[model samples]
Target: MDVTTPPASGDGPGTAPADFTAAASPGTVTLAWTAPATGRETAEYELYVNGRPTTVIQFGAGAVPSGRVEHRLTVAEPTGTAWAVKLRARLPDGNWGSFSAERRITLVA
Candidate 1:
């Protein structure tokens, strides 16, 4: 695991998009995010759940200029009351930007 540099403060081109949605089952949640404004240099995105390396999804060839890019994630076969899901950008240069605000969803019984 690589340590990422702290994002710029005061909202000076350093804010990530917020993703949200409710899951139908326990330990599951929906995810979405706007691409990083400053981290356009990123190559791929690393989706994380509860601070762990969860998934690596590839970004298209086009440069991630700015503004939001939304994505959806599902926890297969959830097994708990709720789940925490987060998404982050991974630059092609091996630098990771900031992460989206974590979201919590309850599982259906």
Candidate 2:
């Protein structure tokens, strides 16, 4: 996980994480993004894989610009498979921001 560099910050209230990226390695995929302004206010990040709600990322979601986040997952699917990913954050106070622009990655060895 790399947080030393800041990605794009919030465009405005209710905005999604900034500069979301996904990178594929032999058997794992790494996802990273810059948190939103309200990230620290109590939010759960939802990871979507292939357009389905996959899991809730335990890492903080709205950590501001300096709280860039990175998560890696092991891939069990076959190589050359296509992985489409998206992210959105849900706040305990009833705020579900928009989903981050989708990122695509092809699995490789």
Candidate 3:
């Protein structure tokens, strides 16, 4: 079992399709993503915002408990700025997969 990051833009045999979903609630942004085809079992999902990584959530196979990796990111105070949510998968062997498409969303006050 080989674990690797997702391929760079225009750099993979096939473009792995990933889903970036966001749900705005009273005080948090529920973010999620679909799994990517990395030829290996994924162990977790890493989330990044703006240009910095925020957190890495653990995932278990069949534990599809939620099926999707979710992040409950909080807003300090709803600033009118666009935030980029990027996702990456971790292989069961401990290798980080490539990042999925960047999803940008704005917070309206």
Candidate 4:
């Protein structure tokens, strides 16, 4: 899959997260990112895999910006595969933030 660079700052819904990371093991890949200090309570996170929107992860009402968020994907491929993953924060107003830096991971069999 193609790797997409994050958009310029102040271009999208909000600021993107920093220090994005990903780890892969067997059939699963885990993605994590530092929360942004947008001053809005994040309601959810949109996860993109291979440039496609794959899932939405919801946050608690009292979620803190200093905390990190993580999501694990159970890939369906038997021989493993390479994936480009990114994340965007969703505010309580239902607006999405700029995508975090993309992280690439290769799941091994």
Candidate 5:
């Protein structure tokens, strides 16, 4: 998917990403979610790990409101440690939305 940076303002507040899910393997986790319906384009998505912000991205081109976005992340921490993750996005139609529900993940060695 494509990605870009835009100001965090819109006509109305955007909705949160839905159906967040994760899968884990040795040292890594794959995260996925359905983006919110933000109209024309999907704005910036902020990824939080362990309760702290980690990354920001956009689901370029197609993955806007209803698209499913998937991300693979490498966690250097030891396996079995809980990884709490969530996402907040700047909706193209409104201000940044609240983060999606938290998803806890654990890597497997």
Candidate 6:
């Protein structure tokens, strides 16, 4: 019998999360996004702050079926420093997809 491995999933995830936003209050920043279609696999989200990978957030199957995922991060940047926040999702295959549109926010005291 001939055996062959199935083709790898082309490229990466289909599309990035559509609704991504960030807000800053005092010394913390809040990021939120609607769960993207994961092609039926669990998705791991990566958070990029000012072009650096800062954190990874995971969403299991059916984790956020009705609402969006939100996280609050404490920042120590000086006031008036603008920060760029972006997000990307990874498939179970370890491929990181395109990043979401960046959201810029200035920190407050």
Off by over 4 Å in 5: 1-14, 59-66
Q: Give the least accurate 10-residue stretch of model 4, judged by summed lDDT.
A: 8-17
Cα error, candidate 4, residue 97 (Å): 0.7
Using alpha carbons, what is the TM-score of model 6?
A: 0.73
- lDDT, candidate 6, 3-103, per-residue tens: 99999878754457668999999999998877667765435789998999989877666763434778788889999999899998775567877788899
Candidate 5 residue lDDT tens string, 2-106: 999897676664488888888889877898888777665565789898999889866566554457877888778776888888988786655778789998887
Give the alpha carbon lDDT tens digit for every residue of 1-109 in model 2.
7668677776556568778999999999999987766735434688998999999876444542256777789888889999899998765566777899899999988
Which scores greater on TM-score, model 1 or model 5? Answer: 5
Error of 2 at 64 (Å): 11
Summed backbone clashes in each candidate are: 8, 2, 5, 0, 4, 0
Which residue pairs in candidate 2 have backbone atoms (N, alpha carbon, C) closer than 3 angstroms, thus clashing?
A: 39-62, 40-62
Top TM-score hit: 2
TM-scores, all candidates, are 0.59, 0.75, 0.63, 0.74, 0.73, 0.73
Clashes of 3: 5
Q: Which 10-residue span in candidate 2 carries the lowest summed lDDT?
A: 58-67
Cα-based lDDT for every prediction: 0.59, 0.79, 0.67, 0.77, 0.78, 0.80
List runs of model 3 lying over 4 Å from the truth: 1-17, 23-25, 38-41, 60-70
Collision pairs in model 3? 5-97, 5-98, 6-97, 6-98, 64-67
For residue 97, model 3's alpha carbon misses the true position, in angstroms, by 0.5
Residues 7-108, candidate 1: write the lDDT tens digits: 766656654444533345443354555666553445467776667887886756685434555445454654555557666776445677677777776555
Model 4 quality (TM-score): 0.74
Preferred candidate (TM-score higher): 2 or 5: 2
In Å, residue 72's CA in model 3 sits off its true spot by 3.0
